[model samples]
Target chain A: MSTVIDARDLTKEYKSTLALDAANFQIESGRIVGLIGPNGAGKTTALKAILGLTDFEGELSVLGMDPRHHRDRLMREVCFIADVAVLPRWMRVSEAIDFVEAVHPRFNRARCEHFLARTKLTPSQKVKQMSKGMIVQLHLALVMAIDARLLVLDEPTLGLDILYRKQFYQTLLEDYFDENKTIIVTTHQVEEIEHILTDLMFIRDGQIVLNTNMDDMGERFVELMTSAEHADAARALGPLDERHVFGKCVFLFDGVSREQLEPLGELRRPSVSDLFVATMKGTYE
Target chain B: MKTFSWLIKREFWEHRGSFFWAPVITACVMLALNLMGIITGEVFLRGHPSVMVDGTHLDMIGHYLTAEQLRQVGAGLDMSMLSVTGVLSTIMAIVVFFYCLGALYDDRRDRSILFWKSLPISDRDTVLSKVISATVLVPVITIVVGILAGLSMLVMVAITATFHGANLWTMLWTAPHPFQMIAHLLAMIPLIFLWALPTIGWLLLCSAAARSKPFLWALAVPVGAGIIVSWFSLMGVFNLSSTWFWQHIVARMLLSVFPGGWMAYDPSIFQHTESPMALYDSLSLGHMYASLVQPEFWVGAIAGIAMITLAIFMRGHRDDS
Candidate 1:
């Protein structure tokens, strides 16, 4: 697979504060990658750097084009929806759509109109009068209307309700999926996106603590719970980390196989959220 | 170029409420004022004074004036009323300035800048639209509205003057010089731009810096700064208001010219213009439109360009969210 995004020693500093440490990452062309991080973990900063919204120390490229040097060209192919409810206040829904249509060479007005219809927004409703969720939907409609190669959504569902959030991801999946397109989404709702993500990357303190595919992740990582008597033996299994929840000792193991772990109290597939919690709890060398 | 027009169209649409409402309201108010002046006869019959009693309070208070002097007084009143329309021009500037502030700030607050930046347009187009809006488009609209108001004022004054036996043909034919009016207007281009550039630039910068309620601080800070500057500048100068206006105009002209200090020109290009009261005598007939020919004007314009360039770079690099 070709690398759609490549970052080497990416570092961003604001005054005396370090916003992003020396971070290195690569994303292939066709995969839907989930960027999972806690609040203030530099997820937005990284995305902003990628969008050329700010200057950073390290070299980074999207589609083999340096965003710093060729931001306008790079932006033409890469669409971003940041804080999805921030559509301009004075713009009518139609005028905003027309603005996008006017400026973007690849913007498809028919597609944008169709998406607007699906969202139940009228062409003339002023953005300031719309509800917050409706604004996000409008923003999504605009972003999705563009024929972009890469879509970077930062907290796209931040203020949205469950239904709107579901619709958001559903529309993204149905309308935007293709071999030549890539979507990188960062959100706090990991469980909701676990099914859609082809690959998952967990970043903590500006470092990628976990990088693995969903299929291999299940085979390589297991969640094992043992009775108090067998907890010590379960701890001996080369687990990534263990935690006590609701009076039971649950452990996450990476090196041990299912056949070799049958002696533990219980073995089951760990949900991405559980794995995220386990990974976040421990010290990784 | 097509996209630039499209952008301007969007600006018009966004400001339709203000643009439509403000001028209409202003025209209505001005029409009413003109009508009031006509009916009262104070506007077109000024020198006539309704009576010629000057020796004593009540002795000739009821006495009337000669027909010829009354007509001359009417002519003078008509001219003064026509001059009153100049107030409408200033009103137009205020309304247009309000709209420009909203336009400049709205782009960043609503994430419209992101939408535009994502497209193929350069920052130069984005910034130039503001200059065009303030300098070209709004002024054109203002002038159109001003002409309409002036016509209305002229008609009312002529009818009222004729009622008092003044010659309507003379009032109409030998009216103020349209060329001189246009000349003063041409002179106002740099003055208007110079007076408003920093405010616009500051608003643009603040818009880029703000995430929410973009206009609040974006507007308040610059106005607050202007008030403070005006206050301090007013304190030191003897005839402080004139000096303050001159210095302010010069500074704005400087920003407009050098945007990023591409030239080191003095702001005196604008400073040398006569005050509005003295303009009739102090200004040469040709000098009203002569501002465009100055090297200092170009230098100030370059400074303005440089400032806008710096503002765009700052906005592009700054983290708003």
Candidate 2:
């Protein structure tokens, strides 16, 4: 598969703070990549660098073009939803749709209107009067209307309700996804998006600590729960991550087959959230 | 060209609600006030009087008396309401300025730069739209409102002047040269941009710089900086002369965007000692035009371009939200 986004030794510094440090990553085209990281883990910085939003060291490219040099062209195919709340507070829902229609040559007004109808939003209603959930729904509708090849969403569901959130990705998957389309989403709610993600990237402190495909993740990182004693034994088999819950210990092991890994403890499927928690705990070193 | 038209139209659609209604309300209030003044006999300055006959401005008493007997105007009005129309025009200009600033800050604050950046348009187009909105559109709207306002003034003046027995035909047809008034307005445009360019630049930068509350910082920080610097400059605590101040302001405002020489007039001209237009005319300031073509002006010009470039660069990459 061709790479849609590629970053090599990317570094970003703000005043005295190093926001990103030699971060290296790439996303294949026609795949949904979940970028899971905590706040200040440089997920935003990395995304911005890819978008050419800040001056940074190292090289980055999206769709084979540097964001700094080909921002307009890259942006034509690569759209982003930064924050839904600030989606032009003064604009009416229809006006916002009209704006997208005005700017994006590939924006489908009919699609936007249909999506708005699904959300039960009146086109003439001003966005300021809408609830936070409605704002996300509106933003999602507008973004999904664009025929962009790549969509980057940063904390897209930050304040959205569970119903809207489910409806959003569901709509995104149903209407927006195609063979040429790719989506990179960064959210802490890993499990909610895990099913839609073809690839999962675990970032920590501005570095991609783990980059694994969903199928590979499911195979390689077998979550084995055991007594506290077997946890140390499980760590011996190349532990990728581990965490404690009550008095029980769970471990994620690398290069250990499920059949053989089962001997160490009680093997269970690791959810993306469990993996994220284990990664954060630094137990799966 | 279609994209540019779309940009202008989008601005109109988004802002037209506020832009249109605000002026219409002001216009209604102005027309009402003028109609009130026309009914009463108080439509003139304390020493000077005027009024409108049909569409024509007439100053003679016979014409105003002829017109007065025919109409009651509004609210049992009198001449004292003439100033209301003048106030309306000034209010309109102020409102337009604020509106332009708000429009400039809107995309940045909304992070809708993402939306625009994704389009087939350039940063130049994006930045130029704002410059046009502020320097051209806002001012053009203000001028139109001013003309409407000027009409109101002329009507009131003609009414009172005619009431006081002045010549009506001369007031409308033989009035002072309209061309000269137009020329004065044309001259004011560059000067207005020169004075406010820094503020404009600041707004554009802040829009890209902040994720939230962009305008407050965009407006406040610069005015704050200008005040602080001017205070120090006044107290002899800073060595930068007014000439240097103008140069810096010009550098920051117009940097790299266009001919830096745009603001390269002689320092003495800005002094209220003489009106800028009179100074421009008397000095045959072809020298001022010559100054703009210089390398120094180019350097300042480069700065303006660089600031815009920096803003685009920041806007393309940064994720404030």
Give the TM-score of each candidate.
Answer: 0.79, 0.74
State the displacement of the C-alpha of residue B86, model 1, in Å, after optimal TM-score superposition. 3.3
- Per-residue C-alpha lDDT of model 2 across residues B197-287, encoded as one tens digit per residue: 5445555666656666765775566456667666667535465574465456624442312212244344533444354334334322343
- Compute DockQ for each candidate against the true complex: 0.41, 0.37
* Worst-scoring 10-residue span by lDDT in model 2 chain B: B71-80
Residue B151, candidate 1: Cα error in Å is 1.7
Cα misplacement distance, residue B48 of candidate 2 (Å): 16
Interface root-mean-square deviation, each candidate: 2.2, 3.1
**TM-score of model number 1:** 0.79
TM-score, candidate 2, is 0.74
lDDT of each: 0.68, 0.65
Error of 1 at B33 (Å): 0.5
Model 2: residues with Cα > 4 Å off, grouped in runs: A225-250, A263-266, A283-285, B13-23, B42-89, B96-121, B152-321
Best by lDDT: 1
